[model samples]
Target: MIVHFQDKTVDEQSRTSDLPIHIRSIKDFRKQKDYESSLSDRKKSKLDINKKKLKNNSSAKINKKIHKVQVYNKASDANFLFAVLETIDFNSHRPSNNYRYPQCVFRFATIIAIIAGRYAYEFLRMNLRFLLPTIQTIENNWSYQPYKEANFRFEETQTYLSSNNCQYVFVSEDCSAIIPRIEYDASLDIFNGFVTPVVEGLPTENAFRCTTIQQLKNLFETNAYANLVNIHVAQPIADSNNALVLPTTVLAAYGTDHKLTAIDILKRWLIIYKKFYSRGIRVLGFSTDGDPKFLRAMRLAANFFVRTQILNIYNNTLAFKVKIPSNWMSWFFLGSTQLFLFVQDGVHLCTKLRNRMLSKSAELTMGSYEISMEHLHDLIRSTNKLDHNLSISDLNVKDKQNFASCQKISDDKVLNLLLLNDKYRGTYNYLLILNLLITAYTEKAIALSDRIYCASIVLFYVRLWRIWLHIERSPRKNTLSEKSKNKKKDQSPHFITSNALLCIELNAHYLIYVYLLIEQNVLPQSIAESTYLFSSQPCENIFRNARALSGVYSTRINFTIMQFLKRLNKLNALTELKHFEETNTEQKIVFPVHHKIKRFMDKKQSNNNNTKLTSFNTHDLEKIILHAYEIAQNMANFVDLSNSLIKNNMFNIEQSSKIAKQLLHLNCLTESEIVDVDGSTDDEESSDDEDLDTYNKELADIMCDGDFSEDELNTSNSFENLQGTTYSGVSE
Candidate 1:
């Protein structure tokens, strides 16, 4: 019997002995000197020695030697090689039937083969054989229980996956057991409890039935079938499961086996096509091998969305061309697919022709459209055929010349010519033409507005005539002197001559008449209220103002100040007007004023130029008006001052008395001296002194009252006592 102790007690035996104690007194022990002196002596001795000599010495050489060295072992390399071999082995036996292995292993192996100088499975297996021995040893001895503490190492190498203790399971398989297998294992273990029994036999039918039924059930329950359809149609090679099925199906369908002929593959594809079509699903056409059967099936199943794999007929000796059935072409080629692909491909075969047609149509619609005949004439003229070809051609000489001249007309001029025609008259059409002209001008790409240059000249002259009319109606004031003494002065000879206005107007009229003659085969109506010549209200106002300034009104104002100033120096004005003169300078002076004016007037006037009555006509007119306005404003200031003096008694009869008083205050003269303002000498001195004082006082007042604040005095009494005294005579 073994005795156990819970609360059991044990008796202890004690041994008694006394030991002698030793003690030392602090006063009896003597303290030694610090070790610092010895250490300092040693350090000083070392520093005082010759460094170079010491370094060369054997002792220093021994001290400089490395203390430790890292050593490489063969075991590390062996481990690395082993890991690489294991990875290879794992990849080789990836256990496709088992779900334990990651689905990406096959993909990874394919990637490795592509990158690692291998293409086939046999090549990979051959290379991996050399590394298998080392991997087997590691795998056999690998501890599964202490997996976390496993110590394995490899050398520092780029070839192996790792150079340290990295544990990796190369191959893993599913270990699921069925009920019958589990029961059998339990019965075998019971029977062979003491002795090992080898239980080997064929698998029972029940087990097969169970597995097959479960697998079929799983296939039905999961979306694997639907996923397979999707892989075959929507995205062929995008899914892993689909990718796995694809290669097998492709090889089986196209295989050389007895059951898998080309026709057989076609039949299988047709079956799949019918199945998908019955379910209202669409199948993708085969992209790799050009299988006609697949294409036929696709066309039959979905005629509207058919895709044809074009055969390389370019290199074929026997050139083959197929005239697609009319209905087929109309259904597929002319359908949305071509349009869709055209948009997707970003290039259309018909783009150039379409653009050309569009351009021509736009031009014709805009009224700026040039006839092809005119373009042909232009081509002829550019080739220098105007002189030589006219005689050789069947066309009449005059007709050829006319054609050449018409080609010279710009696009805008052609459009304007069309616009001038009553047969093509419409406000909407005119606006459209204007918009097209503006667009052509802005783009600068098309030669749409080239002919418009001639039309622009006419427009320019029309603008000038309208501007002249405006100036003549509203005559601006001319300040020749500050006194406002001259109410009337002879108009400047330039203004009277009417050459400038006439030149602009005539140029406009000539261009318009030319356009009319070329376009309508008739001269424009009289320059009054004709359909071709309509003046806006502003133009009429300008004419009115011009006539008024021509001495028709009693206002007695100067007309066209710029013209007046220009006439003051005839040679300079004439030089400025030279650009406008169509004929010799001597001939211009001989023309009557009315004739000159008519020449300046545009032949065909449009109301568009003068939309508003007050707006300036041209840049020159605007500048002249601005300058004249500034001068008038200055004169008004002077007039305002003169008017203000009347109420202040500052410009009244007692002017001399006021001057005398101011002079006396300034101390420039005594009261008696200032009173003697009659004598020539005294009067001169007094006037001079008074003028100086008044100027100084005025300057001070201007400085003080410059801002014109309300606080400033406006009292009438301040200047009332100084009657007849001019502001200039006031003393400081």
Candidate 2:
């Protein structure tokens, strides 16, 4: 476990993803040392001594020598080096000289060994100094049972969490079972106390059920074989800050194959929440991923109180009956203290949306107006010179210029096909559009407000689609106005086509809903500003770290507990290191371990620690606010945005004609790419069909019914339109 200086604290959260740090593998280091020491030769020498003693046992002096040699060999076999080897069964099934491990297997084993070796070496080093007493040490000193310390620590952590008023905890649960290979007699038969087993490595009819740890011990010669389900907790220390603290408390653990239901999971969750809530700690929500069964259970648990007062406060009912995948959730869960929000991870949503687009199952959104996989393939082929003579031809000047731009970008390699997955090509095209939008903000070419406005509009479009899909799945009919007096003759380049215009209008309608939500202050500041809070990636990240630290040598449950504690310690240490860098903490603690200390951990200890104080920057907040206000300008008057969208779609010809007159001489068609309108040969048709088939192939079979109705215009009246007017249209 890592130690943090007591006097320091974390002040803020960072926006950037944490860099993954790689520590040297201790197992490999130990293996190298063992190889150098020639343990194999020592084992052979010991065997030779045994043989000699058996031959010369006739003499008393030789008998004494034999006894001493036997004792030494037994002790050597039980030492750390051989014990480590035994853990892996390496020598038991030595590989032939010609047999070599696959590159992946070797790499994985090396990594695992490194981690295990680090923990083992650290434990030994600390134990030798009598400084850091582990559970084993405590158990040795006390008369408690196996799980007593764990239980006590869990209760202690709950008390601390209550005092801190920590809420919005992220929970992750996973199950690990005893592997069949690890069980010594996986195929063994047993007839209980009355009969001898006939076969080895084969189970008898009576041995079907795993009743106790004693059964595992009988099978594996050790009590380490057991299945377990573990639950972990992570909570934010401050709502205004992004610093999350991982507590070393296993909220609940069940024996493997325990018939635990969603209610069981919820009961445990509520127990933790209520403990804190009763003490004034307000838990707002939970974030978890993986295990659809468990998530479904959680959904059931959340649905139990759907009609509760907290949930009823909102005008619209939030349903929780949707299929719970890794990232997407159907509804919010309600609790006593706060309305619990279920997050569908944004990163995964992006991937899903991209995939939907690639498969052409994408509900024909703004980004997919004219882009297709054929275009992407053509660009790739042209750029790679596979079709060096490919050129834009046989088109009008407007079409030719548009094709030329596409050709130029293709030739310039703006999209790298080699770096992208074929299955995610559609997702790629959408991100290409996002890349442009993000670039506009990052480069400061567009105001942060404009970028955020665009992002919000995009999100509103997505949310609107979700709402429609959730409630019903049918396209709405919108009568095309043949004699409208206020429609734009030529729409902006971005919405040049009818479909693009319609999608944008539908999006604008939903933007009103989002504006109302902002007015209500229902969203977390992070979500309201950047709209990127819909990610469970952080929890996923924590799970990843947990898995990496849980070495293969120990029982999964024990290792998981150890790994979680170590992670909590590491995070605490990191927090203190940052705090100490800012302030002069006179009191400090030092811990020496085998793993190379990080630079921050190795900072010089002194009254004034000489490290420069780096003040936390909140410039992102300024950018977010700037973007929010910019979007609020047009969104404030939903009528103006509605008018622009309507005119662009030719729903109001008079307004459209006035805009068209202003751009009468401008090159409107120059920006629109021409599709395969040119006459195609039989070969070209075949090629196009083959490419289309690739795009049509679905990576995942589960496709949501994406059909939605957004043509209705009456929904906007219910939402309040803020007052602001920086009148401008969508970008070309």
Candidate 3:
């Protein structure tokens, strides 16, 4: 147990999503070194080891204790009692002809089971006949949210949001790559894969159905849709279950091209903002995977200038200690509501930085130290990869980036051998920057001071590294300022990519804004008291799980858009469960483990370490920040940042205005991106934990209303080649 002091007290409340809850394969779990190292030659099945430890009286006296069993009123308890009572007499243990099951049990079981496969679900039902509900009952009660291209069920969604008390939400829009193929939806009776048309910004609902051969021919003549742009809304509810922020999929659409321009994006964002605002729901932010177009929209949307005035209260501190860039356009407002923040996916940013390090054309350096794969290679070569977690395979450049390699390379613990020596100090500094950003984006909540300190250090070094970027005819020194570089080669040369720079700037500014929000008195208690919430990870995670839920096709990873529509709720269920694991620390979210499955008795739970907010020292890094500031300050004089990261030739004259304007009469607004904090309080229900049972019931309810639509996920021919039809197994 860890004891807390006054300065270093640890609160039991959950930190953040604390997610990245990896559901590893059995082989991967078994391969963990800790699992292998813990076992001796003598160690066999755990049954033997457990038997030695059990008291002889525990199971031997079961018969005598059977009658003493006190059955509780709960269904779980009643089922346990029934199982105990039947042990002694099989004939006497007859169940009623129509035994009613608690919907809660079916809610817990059936939805998740069916997604795995129809056959596996049947096998479980056959084994536990009395414990489960029949598939027919489930089929009659449940239904999938029908496939409507570009449909956002506004009223139904509002009812759901109101019921669940998700008032403040962050909207994340990203395109998940799918197998580009035309598919028939059995329910909608329409052919998809023809790119949905986007007018202004909104994707027109039920458009371009290939009912005739000519339309089908046209689709064949052109490239079929490759990616589904999913606009999802996420609420910050870390465990406690009461504040359940299950991602509501607003729209899943695809278009003629894989890109959306800033104007196109801004229009759609405005439409969504208006819809949520009209319903009394306050949107707090928007997040995406650092897409250039989306970043431009984010810059226009940010209301940082309005909040910048609040910094005058700390004027004595600023320019006194460090120069904080205050004009960060990373958040904005809609209607009379609050200033909405912008979040670029943290995972993507880290990957970009690593990829830049790996790029042949760029150099990453700080002072006398240069960070490259060569240093890592030297360490690996010296030990011949002896006891090394990182391999040469991790260093390869690929379009499909591997985050596991990023984690390992960024790990100070894994590279502690190199860190101890001064010769590899540049490597240590580079990893330090990587680690800080990872923590800011992915880890538990950190202190206001700590977050800023981390952001400042990370941002500073990134700028310093850019100054050292390799130029064709120049020495590897601090001389090639932005002015010295050719204007024509604006995007061609130098290390820092546009997205990376914006993210670095925005992330640093966000850290500073965390404190600003608290001071401005505009933040909800939940937002003010938490770690970073604006990440596109949830959107990414749901898509990853979409492939996982696609049973037989999982091996091939063929997730069509139709398949995604079918498993949408299941993906959300996985998200909810992930949240439960991260926050509900006392009672584990349980899944059935069969007796045949091997259990790791000694595997360390490294994930648990991430849930708690970290407290650390932030002293004595002034010289580094100063040097970084000097180079950045010099470069800023000539660099035109608006070329890539910001919008030009337009003011915030028309933002979030693509839809029919209604809420707050926002049509009359000017400088629309900037906001006033004098808006009405969020019409959010108090997150009373007393009704948390309703939370479980709601999840069950959300899942219960459906079965797979015919041809919904049919990767192969129909198995019922005889649904004409069968009862259990025998054909009728």
- What TM-score would each prediction reach against the true structure? 0.15, 0.37, 0.62
- Candidate 1 lDDT over residue span 487-509, tens digit each: 22212211211222222222222
Question: Runs in model 3 with CA error above 4 Å?
Answer: 1-99, 210-231, 237-256, 303-339, 383-388, 414-416, 419-423, 465-494, 552-554, 572-589, 592-732
Instruction: Put down candidate 2 lDDT per residue, 650-677, tens digits, no spaces.
Output: 2232333233322221211111111111
- Candidate that would win on lDDT: 3
Which residues of candidate 2, in runs, are more than 4 Å off? 1-154, 162-232, 239-250, 253-272, 290-338, 357-429, 432-455, 463-535, 550-732
Q: Let me know the TM-score candidate 2 reaches against the reference structure.
A: 0.37
For TM-score, candidate 1 versus 3, the one ahead is 3
Residue pairs in candidate 3 whose N, alpha carbon or C atoms collide under 3 angstroms: 142-704, 142-705, 142-706, 143-705, 143-706, 270-656, 302-331, 302-332, 303-331, 303-332
Candidate 3 structure quality by residue, lDDT tens digits, 1-732:
245553244332232224244534443566776577667434756757677657565765774466445332332433533432343234235564545544334344444464556656667767765665555665544433543556765554565456455676667777766666668866677666656777766777766566788877776776457455454545433222233234444344443355566656765765565566657666666888898778766654553222122111112211112222322221212212224567788788888878887888876544455667788787777765544567888887884367777787788664676665676766666666677777667654354555556666566545434433322223545343332333333243345565687677766665555455544444433454344556777677666656566454335654566566555544433333333332333323354543422122111123233335322222223333344444433322223221221232211212211111111121111222222122222223434222110000011111110022322432210111111211110000
